[model samples]
Target: MRIVVAHNRYREAQPSGENTIVDAEMAQLTAAGVEVLPFIRSSDEIPTMPTTAKALLPISPIYAPRAQQELSRLLTEHRPDVLHLHNPYPLLSPWVVRTAHRHGVPVVQTVHNYRQVCSSGLYFRDGMICQDCRGRALGVPAIVHRCYRGSRAQSALMATTLAVHRGTWKSVDRFIALTTAVADHLRDYGIPDERIVVKPNAVPDPGPPAPLGDGFLFMGRLTPEKGLDLLLEAWRRHPVGALGPLRVAGDGELRPMVEAAAAERPDVSYLGQLDRAGVRAAIEASAVVLATSTWHDVLPTVIIEALASGRPVLGTALGGIPYLVGAGTPREPAGTGPASVASAVRGDGAATLPVGVVAGEAGWVVSPDPAALAAALPVARTGAAALAPAARARYERTFHPDVVTKQLIDIYADAARTAPRH
Candidate 1:
């Protein structure tokens, strides 16, 4: 099948998991012998444009007509069976859905974030999960609070774009949600339950379990939403000398803080801005992965990567992490059972536990507080080995490229066949 995968990448200085996932999916399709065409736009390229163009960036609701024209032309030329969209904010806009419909290509969108419901994209503000605008008019409270980057105008523009294109809902045939919790959340916002499918992010097999290291590892952008401060606080309170060293990989706005904290704490190590290979090595070497996020995140790639490497995770019990850690069952302890076992397997093995835990399991979820994280640290350290096998088994079954590729292909094919003809 001929597929056109279009994505507007976030800026590279702060990379997004969706960008990685889209690139991986495209590569997977190509390897499977599918004709894959990628249409990519980068945030880095936008800054180089003329001032007038830059000034108009916030008016995506108005400029969407031009974007639709361009997309329609591309579709007319490529005639892709399906148009898979990842992120279309700021520049491309939701009008791309209409363009795909005009060109008789089925549109399949992945709700990578909550941009449609929350103008800030993340339901986070002032270091807390802010859902004040949920189920309300997009611009109502978000604009009042200047949610997006603390700019009222930008937040208003995003809210308007979502409001204006709310009618474009008919243009999309399917919405691929990273977790069922997210799908249900979208449903609460009026997106049809039947139109959304739960397809968690997957990671490549990272071979067999390596010897677990001594230190705890944290990977991801060093940002406030990621709960880096909380991680640091937890480290400070960690039963002095009871915890191993803490290594932070990746860079962002909070780098200086991370560096300072590392300097202050002898056990903390800041490995600033590691490449993909370096991140993989870090995951393999770490005894446990820390996902101390303050917001309600969709599926985080780092969590999946940790599982694929046979590492246990200590995650915040907020947003999609709980869903990924496993459905809440009293039978198993947090971060134990089938998911960990499944992710530990050498190759293509099914997790023995329920699907929810296998993909969602293999992690400990604590309250988003530093005290809570500190309280959970000992548990994470002690449970790491017990959860490794199950975590690995989950990775083999759900995240293996060979397995996830087929699921994506099926979704694309179904969208193509079911989408209305122009």
Candidate 2:
């Protein structure tokens, strides 16, 4: 099937998993014998836009005429069977979906973040998960709290964009949610059950399971939301004991704190930001991977990568972490619906929500609080060997490229059938 993949890449200054996922998926499709055409824009290009255009960026999320025209041109020329969208923000707006409809091409969108319901796209504010804007009429609460990049004006513009384009988002042929929890949350927002498809992100298989490594690994942005502080506090309280030191990779605002913790404790080591190879090596060198995010993160690539590397993940029981770690039960964790799901809805949802199988069955899932995580540390260290196989098994069943690509092909075929028969 011929498809057009459209994405607005986040800036590289703070590398994004969305950017990596889009690039990887395109490569996967090509290798799977599908014809893929990329129509991409980057946040890095914002400064190069004309001065007049730069001045209007605050409202660009609502509509970008240039993006519309360019996409229209591509649609007319390529006549793609489907237009697959990832992220369309400041430059490429939701209008692209409308534009695809105008050209008789059906569109499929992937929900990489909570952008439609939250101005910050993270559902996070003040160092906590904040879902105040979910299902709200105008997302006024986001603006009131300066949720987007800590700017009220910017948040207001994003709120306006979300409010105005709600219909455009719902009109897409399909919404590919990164997890079942995310899919359920979309339903709570009134998106139709059939419209949302649960599809987890995949990483290339890093080969057969390697021998269990010593210690654990933490990688990704060193930010509050990522649970950098929470991880350190938990480690300081738990202190690894004798299973080797905790190796940290990645850099951000919390570097000084990480460095300080390293200096103060012999069990913590800050390796700074590692390149892709370094990250892969670290995963193979660790007994478990830490995804200690305190926010409702869509899904951290690290968790999947760790599983692919045959290492179990010990993540907080929040957002997609529980789902990735394969913890909890499948009966739907409590409070995942509109009445209960919140930016700070942590422990309450662990029961009724989808937390998958517990650590022994798959991987570990603990609360984001230091005390909770500290308590689970020993369990992870002790069961690392028994959990390694389950982790890799999960990777093969769900995230293997061949597996995900087959799902993608089916979705593309379904979307193609929905295209206007003009």
Candidate 3:
């Protein structure tokens, strides 16, 4: 039951669902009587790193010798049964996987995004979904486009890191995919079907559904990829009218746009980024949650959090979203059927499907187009109250922390069995 939980925290400037998931899982495991040995690195520390350490950041992704040495020491000291890795970019490298394996500790990594194939890890570019580097041996598209942080050098470095350590990723005893789509993406990258497991991230339940408050809730990083613009356009086309105001939480590159829209329209209010409790309160108060991301998001936790709070989501039918919102059933492993083949041929870009409006529960799934989003907005206004119970039901059945934690325990046990006997 003892494990080393390793993760590299993303920069604190932007809210990170991956970071949220890691913290929640660690807390849940400890509460469940499992011992967690944390091995963590923070992007916040990068700016404060000494001059020599700053120089080391470039090689950190490729192979951080010091990180490997420290991890080796941790393995020798703790003798953990399993090493569970979340994000291993910039600070901790794939060397940790090799280090864990060398020390007889099985490694279990969570595939949080499309980082294995796309340099930005977002599978996005130029305000649109892009997947030009998939299955490519060299990842030249990322280099050509400067996808990561808009720096060719950084993007090239990430691409090189992926190329150099493709085998190191395969060395993992298990890959925890956040959704069926994520598992399918991993398989598309040549990971074996048996090695990948579908495990969606779950949030701590926010008790019972609060009384329905007002219009809708759109929360998360307010970036282009999040499709905030699309949401605004949809709102412009179809004003909130009788339902109530549309509340937007979080800040990013699109703050001015949000602020301008809020000023121009009384129905749209931009509430700056809210903390965890704030987000929950908003979810509880809102009639529906909005997830308008244009990219193939692995599994936006906001959708699940809303469902957990008994608020249905009106989200894009992209990536793992349709599955997350219960608009569609879980996809089978890749290549299992004709649909799988079609999905593969479609690449990793966000494919807009027809509007799905579920009755009584769940929510609507629409294309990112403003017209499509405009068409689905009323579904939330009309059906969200009735769908509250079903939203909570979905959370309990699939994303309850108790349920997901047990699954984690089983995965850890399976991974531990793969480790060499002491």
Leading candidate by TM-score? 3
Model 3 spans with C-alpha error above 4 angstroms: 329-361, 419-422
Q: How well is each residue in 1-422 modelled by candidate 1, as lDDT tens digits?
A: 99888888889888678888888888888999999888777778886977877776767644555567778788888789998988886568777887788778888998888877788888898888888887665567889899877888877777777777767854578999888778877788688776888888776677898978776899898889999998888789865557887899888999999999878878888988888889888887788998889898788899888888888788876778876666342223466532222222212253232211222357667666665567567667776887788788878877788888888889988888776786
How well is each residue in 1-422 modelled by candidate 3, as lDDT tens digits?
89999999998887898899999999999998899999999989998989998998998998988788989999999898899999998899988988898888898999988888888988899988898998898899999999988899998899999999988887788999988889889889888888888989889988878887779999999889999988888788764465588999998999999999999988988889899878887877789999989999889999999888888888887888888777652233444431221222112232322233222237767656776577567757877777788889999999999999999999999878764542
For candidate 3, what is the total of clashing residue pairs?
A: 0
Per-prediction TM-score to the true structure, in the order listed? 0.90, 0.91, 0.92
Q: Kindly give the number of clashing pairs for every candidate.
A: 26, 11, 0
Candidate 3 structure lDDT: 0.83
Q: Please rank every candidate by lDDT, starting with the best.
A: 3, 2, 1
Clashes of 1: 26
Superposed on all Cα atoms, the candidates' RMSDs to the truth, in angstroms, are: 5.8, 5.4, 6.0
| Span of ten consecutive residues with least summed lDDT in model 3 | 338-347
Residue-level lDDT tens digits of model 2 in 272-367: 888889888888888989988888888999898988988999887778988887776322256542122223322434322222223534577766
Score residue 400 of candidate 3 by CA lDDT: 95
